[model samples]
Target chain A: MRHALILLGVLMAGMGLSVEAGLLGPLGEQVGHLSATLSIFMVGALLLSLALVFAPKRQLGALFKQPRWLLTGGILGPVYVIVLTLATPLVGVGMTMVGILCGQVAASVAIDHFGWLGSEQRKVDGYRIGALAMILAALWLM
Target chain B: MLLPLIFILLLVGGAVLAAQSSINGRLGAKAGVIESSWLTFVIGAVLTFLLMFFFEPAQQATLFSVPKWQLTGALFGVVYMLAIVFAVPRVGTAAATVAVISGQLLMSLLIDHFGWLSNAVRPLDASRYIAMALLIGAIGLIYLSHQQRHRRLASQPS
Candidate 1:
């Protein structure tokens, strides 16, 4: 039951992203793409900052004590945004998203297989391959 | 040549994105979900600010000049970051990532079909329905695999 809820939560997040893309398209048209991307993070960060103000103080310290390497995760957002900005016009959105989806699934399987970044080791067994095959077929159809 | 390289870079970026989920999820487990999401947004804001300052060419309209409703769309990004941060620690990286991806694909098709949020209406076709079904199947398979793997691990000696 608990797992189902979190899956729903994240799934909704993904759904929200599609809406975001729809909205951002026009915004990007008005402002330059980079500026538009910057606005998203800026606005989001501003909101989170306000939320953090009321958050439990203890977690605030926990945030600072983290290992240096973990901080790199945050950088990926900018990298994704910048790359998409560059790729979208050139390759177009469909191909770009397909590439991203393919990369995500491939890397996810690899990460689980190697137990990288504290994720548990789960080899790319038959079940995982089946799942991957479905995902690829779905992408191809798209 | 440049096109393939850009495409490959996107692929690598996607892979790194999966890794980011695991890493940030672990961070969220240690810290707080809000904290984890906040940290990334802060980093993202600062980095993009600099990038925009340098590279973004001038446009006729600025963010403030845009309709207020458009700005609200950025808030959805926060929702996404928060959800991933909350989910990864609970579901593990691969499961959460796939779940999120399925949701994205599912919604993208819906939005395309309905023309929601001002996007063009692309009516749902046979291919879109098939894609949605496959996505659902894929999500179920990944969830089952994750549960079985964890059950097996739990049964084994530490």
Candidate 2:
């Protein structure tokens, strides 16, 4: 049940992400993707800081001492938002997501296979290749 | 050419996102999920502000005039980021991403169907349904393969 709840939370979060994607395209039309994404990130920062105030305090400064790689956790988010915002108007949300899935699966598989990005080396064999083929076919069909 | 480039950018963005989850998960192992997520927002805010200043023109006037609901994109983003940060350590990055992809596809279908948020309405059709089913099949294959790999590794002596 605990695991199930976690998966459910992930799923709900995914749904929320999709909604954000949906909103971003139109918002980007009114304001440029960069401007819109900047605003969103600012809002996210505000919301997170508010939550932190209520939670137990930690040595937040310690995170700054960590390696640059780990500390830059938030960097990719704007990249994703800007790209999604740009693609949505052209391709629509479905195809945009299809394209994203393709990139995600390819990158994830590569990361596992090569142990890139500090991951354990998971082999790339026929089974994994076949799964990727299916996902590619699915994207093509979409 | 522009369209394809946009798509490619989106793809790279997705790949970056996968990497971010793994990175953030590791970060979370130290600082806890909420704090790690907060840290992410901090860095992201700075990066975005710079981007907004240089590349994107100022649009504060248009921004405030828009519907209040449109400003809520950040709320969804926070939830999404927090979920990935928490799920990555528990389920591992690939499985967590697959779950996210599934949810995204489902919601994307709904949004396209309803034309929500002033989006273009693309009604559901047989091809789209088949496409979604294929995605599900892909997810099953990935999940099953992941499980088998886990079992195989577990049985091996450390």
Candidate 3:
């Protein structure tokens, strides 16, 4: 029972993310997508900043010595925004979403298979393959 | 074709998302999770500002006129980013992703059914129900696989 609740909590967080992301499309229609992207990140930055103020400071200097790859996450943020902004109009929201899902599953599987980006190396077995197939089917149903 | 290219971009976007979580997890290992998340948003804000300057004119009129709730997308983003930062390291990327995707599908169903956030009202039909069930199954399989793998590794001699 306890484990089930934890799983439910994770699912709820995921759902929250999706619902918020879903709203971005309509919001973007009112404001240009680029402008909306800017606004979204701006809000995120503001909120994050507020949270950081109360948090204890860390030795951030070590980050400069880490592999350049570890620090490059910021670059991907704009790419995601651009893709959502551009793809939604061309393929419609549903198709764009499905495409993103497909990409995510495929990428996750590959990343795990290779242990890329410090992820644990997980083998590509039949069960995971089947799981991917189901995800694609879910996309089709959507 | 333009269609294929858009699909490609979406795919790349998803991959980038996975990378973003992994990178943030690494940074979180060094700096605290909240600090890492803040830095990411800070860099993201700067990049977005530059993009806005190039691609979009400052639409001050529409900006202020938008419903207050619409601006909450970023807050949602903060929640999601924080979730990823916390989950990826503990759960491993694949399992964490499956859990997140399942959550997304469930919420998406609710959103479509009620047409929340101005989405079109999509009734929860048989197909939708089946897909949700399949996702639950997928999540189960992914979790089981992770457990088995861990068990097998643990049983082996160090």
Top DockQ model: 1
Q: Name the better of 1 and 2 by DockQ.
A: 1
Candidate 1 per-residue lDDT over residues A1-142, each given as its tens digit:
6777788788888888878887787899898877788888889888999999987664778878998888777799889887788898899988899888888888887887898888667777677788889888988897
- Any runs in candidate 1 off by more than 4 Å, and if so which? none
Candidate 3, residues A1-142, lDDT tens digits: the string is 3334445566777988887778776677777777777787889889888887766775556667778888788889898888887787778878888888778877878888899988768898777887787877887786
iRMSD per prediction, in order: 1.4, 2.7, 2.1
Residue pairs clashing, model 2: none
Query: Which 10 successive residues of model 2 chain A have the least lDDT summed?
Result: A133-142
Which of 1 and 2 is ahead in lDDT?
Answer: 1
Off by over 4 Å in 2: A1-5, A57-59, A81-100, A125-127, B1-11, B58-61
lDDT of each: 0.84, 0.77, 0.79
Give model 3's docking category.
medium
> Could you tell me how far off, in angstroms, the CA of residue A116 lies in candidate 2 after the best superposition?
2.0
Q: What is the TM-score (0 to 1) of candidate 2? A: 0.85
- Please list the Cα RMSD from the true structure of every candidate, rounded to 1 decimal place: 1.5, 3.0, 2.2
**Candidate 3 second chain TM:** 0.90
Can you tell me the DockQ of model 1?
0.77
